[model samples]
Target: MNALSIDIEVNEAHLRQQFEDCSDIVFRSFKLSDGAMLLLVYLDGLTHVQSVEDNILRPLLFNGLPQGEKPVPSLAERMKREWLPLANVQTVDSSDALVQHILRGSLGLLVNGEAAALIAQIPGFEERSIQEPKKEATLRGSKEGFVENLRTNTSLLRRRIIHEDLKMESFTIGSYTQTEVVLAYVKGLADENVLSEVRKKLGQIDMKGIIDSAYLEEWLEGSSYSIFSQIQNTERPDIVAASLLEGKVTLIANGSPFALILPITFWSGLQSADDYFERFVFVILTRAVRYAMTFISFALPAIYVALSTFHPEMVPANLMISIATARENSPFPTVIEVFIMMFIFDALQEAGVHLPNQLGPVGSIIGALVIGQAAVEAGIISTPIIIVISLTGIAAFTIPRYSATMPFRLTRYMILFITGFLGFVGFAYGIIFLLIHLVMLESFGTPFFRPVAPFDGRRIKDIFIRYPFWIKNGRNKKGGQQ
Candidate 1:
């Protein structure tokens, strides 16, 4: 609605008024060799002065101005076509668009009697250079990771997957932040129904800001109430590319290094990039260990409570004697003892994480060695309980993804509470309840407990074990069609 006037001074005045208090806004007016007036407007820190000067100013000054007395439209057209030698240039007719262009680090050139402003692309701002992914490091894959810049991140994905079917659709979310989010997928590989659902959910997001890809994970997911993450988030572009090749959609948001890969199964959380890189035999063994760790982390405490309280005979005679001897000096019951130890373990883990990086490991060592040993020596806790809690903590570290670790921790507490009340029966009941909950859960309309719960034998090869590349069933070359 705010159309530019033919008067150069009037347009400058409007710009000055709009950016009154902003001292960083620059408006430099100059005259061409032929006495034609023009103004250059940009934000100081965001624009590269040298590039603008060399690309735009130098070309205009050396080439001379467009000749003849013509209308504003003709002059503007002539300027766009024959004048500015910059790579990216556009003409803006309204003040609103002009301001937007300037804000995005483009140089705006307004001519004396022209009704439009010429925009030149020369954005310059400091950004973190591409580096190895911090969170999701791979032993044998690409070391390059996604950076904060959206264009750079998309480029990383593009480089790995060079194909015409690899499509990326961008959307602007966040009313205040106006953050850019791109949904990328292979056109035919990804299910149309899943794509439709994802787009619909994305359109429904009306937040004031989406700071990270995690912000979109919950909002885009069907079941927000579930503790388990239906969508997977990773920092590596190779992982994103792999997911895209496997008929999954990836969401990359500006200002965030993490990208979300959707319609992922519950088992996907347990899988890692390392699985694909390692030999199939070694991968199976490694995965088995991780799966065992997950189980131990979630059920160790509850199983101990159930067996010791209700079925002490289940334990070996020598171990039972040792456990009974350890607990003899402790005043609290078995459940209470376990609870205290778990709380202390949780607190120490939290402290270790939140503390300064230098002190984090030191704090963990002191808490584990000093506090735990002191507690046992004082008979405040049993040695066996300490050992169990320590094992549980260590097992949690084996899981590749933090999102999967959370559900393990949550389910552990739930199982512990149930076992404390009804012993072995309650432990079984809690696990059954959890299994049912997981089976009913859905991720982007895809089954959360896929291949395993549905018992798809053909697809099970990649679920628990990674098959060798040569031996694996191949997906169709055209978009991974089954």
Candidate 2:
């Protein structure tokens, strides 16, 4: 227990021991006009040296206590209000608070015969400038994205919505990292019960560290063990602001560009930021295409397997001939061929994401073309199966959010396996079971498949089609519920 009380020398020594061997820690000791000792400690890279020297050091050293007068009305208070020229100053008594403040880019000032220390906020660390969003690019929305700094992200949110009802509740999670987590929502719009549930879940996180916003997403909502994303992740601030306006809660971490939006529904996966920005007709067409792509990505492989194996009549005569000719030389069954091509496609997609930005597109194209052509020529896989998997891969990209694509990828394999053995019936059963499971799931007490499963007519306007802005008003007030 490192405690600072009265004796300035002992306090300095204790702090020095606590920060032993830390090269970046700067400690300076000086004497007042009446010969009282004072100590100052701060981290070199974190605190502003110019502010410390000009605002704090010069003020105290040049205009400090009168020749024979002692500090009146508590030295800590006087120094904080009159002496320190900085804008933000806090008085802390415990050594733990001193350490926390010092580590967070604040200067710690210890006065002789005083038990408390003054914490001056003078943060001067480097941070990246806000740039365009990487993942969720928009053609018509705001271009600015959230940076890694918590304060900057909060400022971005405030700049968009100036309403006093907007509230940001902050907490320090991660015992070792002490990472900052902010839950933002608008009062009177957001549900109090959902907010309480979010707080309770966050309080239950007993981990040693939280590296990013993903950590909180996993801890808070990953308990249901579902493949589909329960919380939507967005780099665009407008998307977050829009969600807040809809009574949804968003969580922002200190060092992460992505924000976690809770009470997300399946319809969220198909909705894009551009939907609200573009004309209603265009948005409807775009959302319709995305919905079609999502369905194709999830069921194309299984549908192909089921039709070719059990229901040849479903395939047109000319297409059947072409497919039969393409599969004539292939040695593997239809299911095996689909599996082989899908595996290669998945590998290429993963490689494209992990590769360097400049080479990612080139590598994916080359890998797909070379491997796909070689497999066809060697009779390792059929051309029809390659086409099926390639279309599925392309369809997976149509979904606006990356997290929403996982369910499609995983469900594709399940449907393929089921259809391989039981033909068309298995495919139908697989989809039924999947939809049933999704209907049972909830996101922070909101239905996962909102406005669809429960069948709400008024709020379902934006589900399959993008309705006009005026018509959609007050639709989402109930959080997509009746």
Q: Whose lDDT is greatest here?
A: 2
> How many clashes in candidate 1?
0
Please provide TM-scores, in order, for all candidate models, with all chains considered together: 0.93, 0.95
Pairs clashing within candidate 1? none
- Clashes per model (N, Cα, C within 3 A): 0, 0
Tens digit of per-residue lDDT, candidate 1, span 337-432: 989888888889889989998999899989899989999999989998998999999999998876678888888889999999999899999999
Task: Give the distance in Å from residue 179's predicted Cα in candidate 2 to where it truly belongs.
Answer: 1.4
Instruction: Report every candidate's CA lDDT.
Output: 0.87, 0.88
**What TM-score, to 2 decimals, does candidate 2 have?**
0.95
